[model samples]
Target: MLKVIFLAAFAVGTVLADGELIILNNPGSVHFEGSQATNQSFLKEVFTVVLGYTPKLTQPWDGVEIRDPFLLPEALVSIVIEGVESVKSPRGKHFPLNVDEVEEVTWQAVSRRLEERDTNNTLVRIRVGDGLDALGQSALGELKPNSVDPASLKHLSLNNEEDQKFIEELQLLRAIAQKIPSTVTANSKPDVYWFVVSGLRPVMDLHGKDSEATKEALKLLNDAVNDLSNAFTDIYNGQVVVALFTNDANKLRNTRSVESPRVRREEKAGELETFDAAAQNSSDNLNTIEKPITLRLSKRYSANYPVIFNIFLWFGIVFFFSLLAICIAIAGMDPGRDSIIYRMTSNRMKKDN
Candidate 1:
């Protein structure tokens, strides 16, 4: 059954997509290549765990063709996961300060540095599960369970073994979908939404690929992905963009698949391929990146005193300071050899005094 999410629109226009950002995790070690992610035939085989199955009639398919051909599959994680933040050098000195005194590290604050197009925070953050923190887990070994102490890093390590992580994650996303505002027609803030879902288990499983224990543990991954994809669509009505990828390293590798990223600003639902698992390592280039219909840039020059209006103001200040300095020097001028005030107020120094 398709679960529907309902929201009343306040504005009177055709409600459509402002855009959406979905971040889902897949196995780092899998190689899901050469899978038909076309809407016509995606269910032929198991790619990764799974997510919502989308209809292809409205959404066409395009595979992202990575230009490289000599990259190793296992190294895709390092290449595909966005590394703009981690690769940056930290502030020269580090002193733990109060929360407000510290810099804003939220996704919205870092969105610019992350190269996000929208800096207005229109992409509402939809955090599904709270275990490993940060919706965008850029690196592996981030498989940690939710902690009670908040500050305590030590907890039941996910070690990427728990199926419950993915299960609870899907559940939370479904529940959260019903709560957020999906009406993007109004000219308001929070125009878009963002969801980050990570499935770090199956591939990171300690057991070997053929091990029954691993298979039993990862059986539900497919169901989770399928359901989440559908639920978001049912709620948003296909007015979203989903870009699924494995690692940022994949971009550097010889991997590529074309995806139907939203280009013309149309309304509809679609699914990009999920994070490629080893068994069905199916990583296709989902086109969450859509070019804007129109782009206008407004520039603001940072100058305290422009040569235009403020120049006089600064010039006046400098002129007064210079005049005052000269006056002070004149007032302090010496005896009979100079001004009347100096002659009256000052006396010749006694010899050797």
Candidate 2:
């Protein structure tokens, strides 16, 4: 009987490891009560503790920032922009000048880009301690990594009507991580995994108004996060990341007088399905207001001139003056510069030769 049970478990693990990567957001959106800078700092400090070193922001992007050495590389980032199909993965570390808002860069788009690059073109790289030393070189070459079927990702939420079983989210995440390749070898192309569970601490006083239950629930959540973090470190070997995406507000509502019903996990799952369907269907419709004509021009750069100042400013000015002078000189000619030219009657006329 024991042997049969062991085999069943092993079979489950085998199937998961061969499946697609799953990324799911924990139930609800919650943020600490604070400014944007404070939230960012708090997040950084948490990661510093986890990673054993502070991670430097790849770019200090405003509105939305995705910081990680392993996930999205610069070359393939263009696939996140407008006309994703036409944008080939180009060389160099050039960030897209214009990109859709982070929220707009849906998981569908990310999955699509990965599908196109799945032909042994995917590169896995890591940088330790935000330093120049790469944990693995991001060399683009033909490398037969494991094949991953594209899958959709979802952001789950738990409202007042939910059980708020955020801890279970971690358990689900563990199952997903188990699906990843157990080991990375020279010939084995493996991928890293992470979960961004947003909406932990709501600005609204969810448990206020002497509602002892919700308050206790909040306290329980704290214990869960710490316990899970320690477990992930030991079990996953610190390869998978658990990121709690949150923001804080200055003022929180005093809901001591309000009694909001908590939601159960089962109901939340159903809601998540509905939410996922709605988000996918309701993505901002992109209309091409101006028909774009693809124009090919030599990639040009200017030395010692800022792009906002227009590096070609001086060149254009010089060009204009030179052009005008030539045009004026020709027009000022007796007839025309390119007209039938007669020899000057006075090369030696002054000398009367």
Which is the leading candidate under TM-score?
1
lDDT of 2: 0.28
Q: Give the TM-score of candidate 2.
A: 0.28
CA shift of 17, model 1, Å: 32
Residue 42, candidate 1: alpha-carbon lDDT: 21
Model 2, position 80: C-alpha lDDT score: 14
Tens digits of per-residue lDDT, candidate 1, 1-353, equal 01111011101001321111122322222222332222101211111111111122122222222222221111000011121111111111111111110011122222332233335433344434444344444222223332323232122234444545644564454444333334333221113334444443333344444555444323433344445444444544443223332222212223211221111112122112232232132223221122211233222222232555477988899999999999999877664545566555556633453
TM-score of candidate 1 to 2 decimals: 0.29
Clashes (N, CA, C under 3 Å) per candidate: 40, 17
Q: What does candidate 2's lDDT look like per residue over 146-194, in tens digits?
A: 2212231022234443323333333332332342333322222222222
